[model samples]
Target: MADPPDLAVVSQPADLTNAWLTAVLGAAVHGFSYERIGTGQVSDCYRIAVRYAPGSAGPASVILKVASADPTSRQTGAAMGLYDSEVRFYRELVPHLGSGPAPGCYHAAIDAGSGAFDLVLEDAAPAVAGDEIRGATVEQARRAVTELGRLHTLTAGRPSLIEAGWLERGSLLNAELLTQLYTLFLARYREYLSGPQRSVCDSLVTAFDHYLALMSAEQRGLVHGDYRLDNMLFGARESARSLTVVDWQGVMVGPALTDLAYFLGGALPADLRRAHYDELLLTYHAALGPEPARTPEQIREAVRRQSFMGVIMSIAASVVVERTDRGDELFLTILSRHCDHILDTGALPLLITGG
Candidate 1:
C-alpha cells in the first residue's frame, strides 16, 4: 500500500472533506458523514463514518476531536496549552506507549496560536462510556485502575517525555483563580451543596497554596488530570481492551497517584469504595511493577493527600465550561463523592496542617 497523503489540519467538522479523509486514512474514500459525540465541555467530538471505494479499505468509523465552539472555553483551552498537549500526546507520546489505555491516533495537528486542534482516533465502538452518576461495578473499577497503572508504567521514567515542555505544563488554576471560582461555585450550588461538602471546599480554598506546594513535592509522572468515569469508555463484548481512556487535553506531568485517587474517589459509591479500596490499590500497585518501588501504605498516603484534585476540578471546571443540566449534575455528583472520600480518609487534616 502507498503512504497516505498529507492533509492540512482541519479546525471544524464542516472542513472535513471526503478527499481529506481519504488522504489521512490511506484509502480511497467515496463519501463520509459525521455526527457530534460526547458531552465534552472544552472540546467537541464527532464520529466520522467513511465509505471506501471498491478494493480499498480503511477504518469504517473514526473519532474526530476539535476545539470547543464556545469562545471562553476555546480561549481557556488555548491559554492552558490543552490543545497543544493532546496533539503532542498523540504525535509524540502514543507511539512509545504501545497498546496502552489511550486510543490509537491516526492524525494529530494543531495551530498553537489559535488554539485550534484536531485528532483522528480509533473508534472504541461496542464499548459503553462509564457514568459518574451511576458509578462503576467492582469488576469495572478494577479494569479501569489496572489500565491506569499501565498508563503510568508506560510513561514513567522516559527522559524525552519528561523533558518535553508541553507535557510539563503547569495548571492555570492557581490559588487566586481557584478561590474566585470556588466562591462562584458556592453561590451557584449553595442550595445543592451539603454542609460537609461546603466545609471541604472552604478548607481547600483557604489552604490552596499549601496544597499546591505539597503536591509539587511529590513524585512526578504523566497524569490524566481528569481521570474519572465520565472520561472513560468501558469495554463490552468483542472490544479489544477492557478499558480505553480518552480525552488527553488535560494530560500533564503531575503527581502520579492523583489519577488513581480522582478515579476511585468518584467512580464508586462511598460504601463500595470503602470495601474495595485496598484490593483496588493492590491491583494498581501490582500492575505498576517494581520500578520506582512503592508500598501499599505509600500509595494510600499519596492518594489521600491528592484527594483534593477532584474538589478543585469540580469547582474550576464547572465555572469555566458551558453549562448544561447534565454538567451541573455531574459536577455536583463528583463534589459530593469526593467530599465523602476526603472526610472518610481524614484527608482534611493534611490540608489543615499544611502537609
Candidate 2:
C-alpha cells in the first residue's frame, strides 16, 4: 500500500470545521475569495468564486474540491495523484467525448511527491440539485448511454495512456483492493452476522480475488471506476440534458461496459432498468458503427462481464450499509432483506466463479 498524501496543511476534522475562516479566507489568497460550501464524503468543498483585476473579466465562477486526504477513507490514504488523476482524466479523456455528461476540469495542483492538493471545478450544482426530489429519467439514461458510447469508441486501445509526469490514482485496480475489502468486511461483520447468511457473505467476499484474477482485461480506456447514478448531476426532470457526471477519484483503465452495467443496473430497480437496458447497450454498440459488437449474445456477455464487478461492489456497499446509523430498524431491515434476496436468488451470480 502506497502512503497517502500528507495533508498536514490542514490536519484534523476540527481544523476542517473552521477551514473557511482559517484557510480560504486567509490573507494568502489574493484577487479571489472563497467560502466553506459544505463537506462531501471525506473532502470539504468550497464555493471558490473568483474576482478579476482592475479591468479583466477573468474566468467565470468555479467550484473547488479540497480533495480528501483523510487517511481513514476507504482508499486508505490519499495521494496527490488522486487530484492529478482527475485533472488528467478531464484533460485526456473528456475531449474525446466532446459535449457529454462529464464535468469540465479547471485549474488544480497537488504537491509533487506529496499528494496534497486542491481542485478547481466547473459548477454542476444546477444539475445535481434535481436529485433532491427525483432520480434519473429515461432520457437522462439514454443520453448517458450516448456519452458512454463516445467514450468507449474514442479511447478503444489506450491503457495507462495518461500524460507523462502526471500520476494516475486508483490505477491499481488489481486483485489486492478487493481482497482487502473482503477482509475488512469479514472483520466488521463477524460479531454482527452469522449462520448460513454469514456463510454466503463470506463466500462472496472470498470470491472477490478470484473474480479479479479470472476477469479478462480489455483495451482499458476512461473507466468511471465507480459508476452509479449518485455520481451524476442532473437538472430538473423536465430538462436533464445538461447532466454532468462528478466524482473522479476512482477513474481508471478497464472495460468501458463495466461502467455501463454498473450505472444502469446497480442502482436502479430491475423493471425500470430492464426497460432501457437493451437500448442503452445498443447505443454503446452504435459507436463502433453499424457493424460492431451488436449481437444479442455479445450484449448479454458484456452485461454479464460487467455485472460480476457490480456484485463485488455491492458487497462493498453492504459492508458500509450494515454499520451505518445503527438502530434504524427500518434501514437495517431493508439492508437485511436486500442481502437475503440477492444471496438466495444468486441474483448477482457473478460471484459463483467461471465468470
Candidate 3:
C-alpha cells in the first residue's frame, strides 16, 4: 500500500520512531526501542521492543533484518541476489509452508535495484542459536533433520517450487564459478587444511561438473543452502518454536539431501555422525510424506554424493564473511568435520568415479 520504510533510517536507533514503526507494522505504534543483535555478516539485525497504543494490536517486539552496511559484504549480497531471495521466500513461500521450524515473517521488502532489503519477523527469543563449533547432541541432531524433512516435504515435487528461478541454483552452482571459488578458497585456507584435506578439495574441483551431472533432477526440492546448527535457533523455553531456521540467503532448488548431507557433515563430530547418522537419516526419511517416495539406500547415496557441499560452503563462507576469532574457529571446525565425513563415507571416490 504505502511506501516501505527507509532501509538506512530504520537500522539507526536514533532515527527510529513511532511513525516509521507504524508504517512497517501497519498499526498505531506509540513507542519503540531497539538494540542490535547477532553477528550477521551480510545483514544488520536488530531486536525492537515496541509499546503499542491502547487500541492497537501487534507483537511487543520484532526482529528486523536489513542489508549489511559493510561495503564488501553488501556488494557481495547484492551480486548474489541473496536479499531478493529471502524477501521473496517470505512473501511467496512462507504462506504455503504452514507451521514448521521457521519464524513468522510479518513484513518483507526489498529494492531490486539497490539490493537493499528488510524483513520484520517474529522474535523467537529464549531460543538459543545452535553452536556449530560445539556441534549438536543426538537429540538436537534428530530434531534438526526432522524439521528439515518437514520443510522439504511441503515443496518436494511441487511444480511451482521446482520452476521458481530465484529459488534454483543460479550462477552459484556453475562449474567455472565453483572452480574459481575453490581455487580462492584453497589459496586462502591452505594453511588450515591438511595434505589429505587439500587433495580432497582438489578432487572436488576436478570433479565438480561430473558431480552436478550425477544429481537426479526428480529429487530436487527446497534446499536450505546453508543449513547448519549456527543458522538454527533451538528453543530454550516451552513457548518458543523448537528450531526456527534463519539465513535463507543461500536457498536453492536442488537435491534435498544436499542440505541434510551438508548439515550432517558439519554439525556433528565424525564419530557421533558415524554412530547415529543412519538413524537420523531414517528420522528424516520417515518424516517425508509418500508422494516423493525415497528409499533409505537411495537417500544414503544422495547424502554421499552431496557430501562435498559442506566443503564448498566452508570455502565460500570462510572467505566472504567478516573474519572473527569465533568465525575462523568455526570455519576450521567445519572444514575438518566435513573432510572427515568425506573420507568416512568414501565421498571423494564417488565424486571422482560418479558412482
Clashes of each: 0, 3, 0
Model 2 agreement with the true structure over 172-227: per-residue lDDT tens digits: 44456656766775665556554655665565566655555545454334677665
Ranking by lDDT: 1, 3, 2
User: TM-scores of all models?
Assistant: 0.95, 0.68, 0.91
Q: After aligning candidate 2 to the native by TM-score, how far in Å is the CA of 229 from where it should be?
A: 2.0
Best by TM-score: 1
Q: lDDT for model 3, please.
A: 0.80
Candidate 1 residue-wise lDDT, 25-113, digit = tens:
98999999999999888999999999999999999999999999988888878877788888888887788888788888888888756
Segments of candidate 3 deviating more than 4 angstroms: 1-15, 171-173, 216-218, 290-292
Residue pairs in collision within model 3: none
lDDT scores of the candidates, listed in order = 0.86, 0.52, 0.80
Which candidate model has the greater TM-score, 1 or 2?
Answer: 1
